[model samples]
Target: MKVEFFFDVGSPASYLAWTQLPKICAAKGAELVFRPMLLGAIFQATGNASPAAVPVKGRHSGIDLGRFAKRYGVPLVMNPHFPVNTLQLMRAVTGVQMHQPERFEHLLKTLFDALWIDALNLNEPALIGRTLIRAGFSIDEILALANSPDVKAQLRSTTDEALERGVFGAPTCFVGDQMFFGQDRLDFVEEALA
Candidate 1:
């Protein structure tokens, strides 16, 4: 089975999905492809804002996310500022995937945790470098790729592709013709697998 996960670093829900759903897919022997998208574009098209922008939903989502985090033992650092720009982080993910797949996953998770859970600004080069190093990644390699024109192009291209594919939200899962939206819909994904 194949599962394509459309995500953005700025989405807390995407971070939650990233931390948890991989285990489920792996257990089913499914191939997981991470598709990084631009949340800003998606929101602009849909006339939507960050969950934090919506008072009620934002409060509720925080509660719900807390449950998932505690259940999965995933520490979430709720960024008080909300919606930090992730252009560099997204490009870095693609670059990391190219140079080191395993470490890429590790760094992605680390960065997500630090941003969503620790509320750190991932856009800063120094902070990003520190996160990578803390995750046991080669800072030099990551910074080199993060600055590479090719990686930047890949990130931009990938974002365009994601938009063209009709992805308008984070945590959108594509399983063949089935499109599952939000982390709450993972049960549907499991059912589809079964």
Candidate 2:
């Protein structure tokens, strides 16, 4: 079986999913395909805004995220910079996944850890550069790839494909055609995998 994980690194829920999916897939003997898409574009196209857009929902979401993190025995600190513009970040991810497939998992771990575990303000370019370097990535190479037209188009295409598949948010997974939204729905995902 295969689990198509449609994700955006900017979403905390996505981070939570990332932490658990590998183990779930491993136990199920399933392949986990990472589909990196632009969340901002997904939101714009679907008229769906981040939970943070609504104050009450945002606060409750944060608390719920904490509860899940605890349940998963994983660390999650909400970034002070709640909504970092991730256009370039997503592009970088797509670029790496396309051009340097070997480094894809490392890049995901680095960025997710920075934003969710370490609570780094990745909105700042310098900070992003430092984080990439600390994670053994080449900033220049990443920048060149991220700026390439192909990478931009791939991200767009992936986001459009996600919308067409009825995905309006991040961390969506598919077991065959069974679309499961949210990390909280992972139990359904596991059942579908079975």
Q: How close is every model to the real structure, measured as TM-score?
A: 0.87, 0.98
Error of 1 at 8 (Å): 1.7
Distance from true position, residue 63, model 1, in Å?
1.6
Q: For model 1, which pairs clash? A: 76-117, 77-116, 77-117, 77-118
Clashing pairs in 2: none
Per-model C-alpha lDDT, please?
Answer: 0.79, 0.96
Maximum-TM-score candidate = 2
TM-score, candidate number 2:
0.98
Q: In model 1, which regions exceed 4 Å deviation?
A: none
